[model samples]
Target: MKKIFIGMAILSAGLFTSCSDFLTEEPKQEQSNELTFATFDGVNKAAAAMYGMFQSDAWYDGEFTLMSELRCGNAKNPTSVPGSGRYRSDTQWIYSDRSTSPLWSYAYYTIARANNVINNLDDKVGVDATQQQVNNVKAEALFIRALCYFDLVITYCQPYNYNATEDDKMGVPLVLVTENGKPARDSKENVYNQIVADLLQAESIMADDYVRAGVTDKAATPTKPAIQALLSRVYLYMNKWQEAADYATKVINNKKYELAPADAYAAMFSAATAPEGGEIIFEVYGSDKNEYWDNSGWAHLPYITTTDDKGSHGDVCATKDLYDLYSEGDIRKSMYKQHGNDYFPTKYSGKPKDSDPKYTNVPILRLSEMYLNRAEAIINGASIQGVTAESDLRKIATVRGASQTAAATKQGVFDERRRELAFEGHIAADYARCNKSMTRKDFDDSKNKDVAFPSYMWALPIPNRECTANPNVAQNPGY
Candidate 1:
């Protein structure tokens, strides 16, 4: 499927919080100035732009991992760049330093884009677009906004306070409407409420018509499945285990998405050739033409390399502990390459020399995650022993025909998730939801093996620029 650009209608300014300048470039006088959200095509383009924000390193490659490390108790040393570069070798990363962090800023950038869509969508001047198109666009925008807020809250603010009222807790900023002026941070409860409202609205709007097998569907955008997947994640974070399990089960059995075969896990990551694997429900697809190596998945993930077809940059190898989690006879073990006694994932290796490295779109949500989630939620909600009660947990585990049977214990499922979903941006969040202790010692002994957690993970201080722009905002705890 040919990729579509959303903000093509909006002028591409460097950065702006204004609704008018959100996605569209300034309209050329030659074209009619009266374009409105009346058609599927126009609205679809705007929806497409939301995904672009994810492709940018500002959101995914850089800020995304930085936030994960914060919660996971992994940080680099003060002498090194705090959050940039391949964290392949032994480099100390400090979590306290404000200089090297871009998370808060990048999150706002995404929020601004989402705000632009929400604000301008209802005002579309054209009538050709139906109420359904407008609703779809709005729902998608809401979904994006909720996702960004959830991302910000988990990293910058404290975890969800189920006991507090929406206005009392300290949550991240909630920019529902686009603003030309500065805005203050909203309470954490307010942010959560807004996220829930947005997701509910998205689920309703999406209904059943928004199914897309891959990135090919021209009308591709979040569907009921995507919204449910996110809600499952949100509820899990909020400690609503039964709700999380229920939502996750809905997706797992929905027939809209499915888990990929364990044997195909290696090939599912190939950028050029991997068929849209069954595991993916939604993703931010990127193209070599539109993206560069530093920002591309092919360039950043270490396992996909040239010489070994399993190693790249000879760095960022999977942790020995993580590697060992897989048992003998587990076919997924083949996904990693252990050349020269070092283990690297084979998932993202670039094609052989000179050939354009295929860049598979990163999976934002997948069936495997939903399965793991169901297991966790069920275990958290009502722990039961044996096959009948532990059925959900067992279904996800024992894949690859390994000796490690499905675990009835919390540790078993948790360990299974770490191995099954390694490096896909789930580890830290999973740990947080589970309320596991995140300390420097854990990373040093595990993933990083030799690295210590920098104080920065407590929360990267809000950027100076943001504080200067909006004085009401306060820095996170210990930052």
Candidate 2:
């Protein structure tokens, strides 16, 4: 867990390269950290760079999202042998020390960048920035760090409630500061506690209405509601049912967001920008104008999920197991389009005019998810006055033109979640946290069609490079 420093040359090329409308200015490259953090302008540029890191292909921009769906029954490779040779390993649940996800390295890289911002904020806060302005930046940094850690823990460690002794299980290293040291893995309990601490402290200092300046897609930046939404999800993972329901209720009660109507459901994701007053609470902003656009070009999710028509890759396809869950009248059922014999999800189908599949924003959180989270929480012994689990579940079902007959039951809620959140990337994590084995009935590969619960494969291996470099960091049990 030693800090991975971004070389000045690499930082100049990647960090300063602005995503259109998200960042307004690019600061001159300075050779030293002092010059970079010396002024409020410099600090602001650094914060923008931290935000830009989310667009990396290893993280939200593509693989992480696609892998989540592919590993679960929600998605599959269209052919037993991948035609494009993309997502084959993931769809087949193949993992080795050398073939693990790059997310471990990329997530830690982003965390190190966030640590730089958090560590320097107090000393650098001067006449250039007000106290409140500095606090907002710090809050944003904390939120980003928490998010990265949460992803790392879920991917590299077993679920919080995996067993009676799960709390003592090894989690990823907790690197809260920018320093040179090989840190060992922290316990699962300690890692989750750190995530909660970071999020709660961020919530205390950030303004409810504060949006980062110069960001065209406001949901890309962390807001009060965004923090709450994440907390709801995190609590649900931790099995803190009451807390999960309460936090979800906070976001659901907010007037800033509303569920997109059934007619506009598909359009909401395919739009260039998030629709105003739409369901998206947080998303990774994608744009053709983004200069650091390496991930969005050909290897983007839109290309992977689309048909070969219009030069797209068409590698990932929706499983019949998932497709059959949607009833005939449900608007969500229309989110898929058939090609040959395979069904591809249209959630990441790029903007209408785009010749290539790029510039499609990726939704990380939405209002519909809040409804799902609360419903799951309520079904597991949490209570809300005048709001049964059925009522919360119906909120989503009604808007999407689906039947609510399956509401109020745990399995029903889980099935509804798969239908509502498919391809947006919650499937694998949902199954793992709930201690349910994945059953991919439509997959062509017989050997991996069923992944048993509590298997070591659920926790992906640490990247080989990290294990080689950091002696103190341990790989997960399977690898």
Query: Which tens-of-lDDT digit does each residue in 326-396 have in candidate 1?
Result: 88877767776665545656554643234443443555777878877777777776332332325665565
Error of 1 at 269 (Å): 2.3
What is the C-alpha lDDT profile of model 2 across 27-48, one tens digit per residue? 5544456677777667667777
Cα lDDT of all candidates, in order?
Answer: 0.56, 0.80
Q: Residue 28 of model 1: what lDDT?
A: 23
Model 1: how far is 414 from its true place, Å?
A: 1.7
> Residue 70: error of model 2 in Å?
1.5
- Measured with C-alpha atoms, the lDDT of residue 82 in candidate 2 is 50
lDDT of 2 at 12: 30
Clash pairs for candidate 2:
none
RMSD of each: 6.8, 2.4
TM-scores, in order shown? 0.78, 0.94
Candidate number achieving the greatest TM-score relative to the actual structure: 2
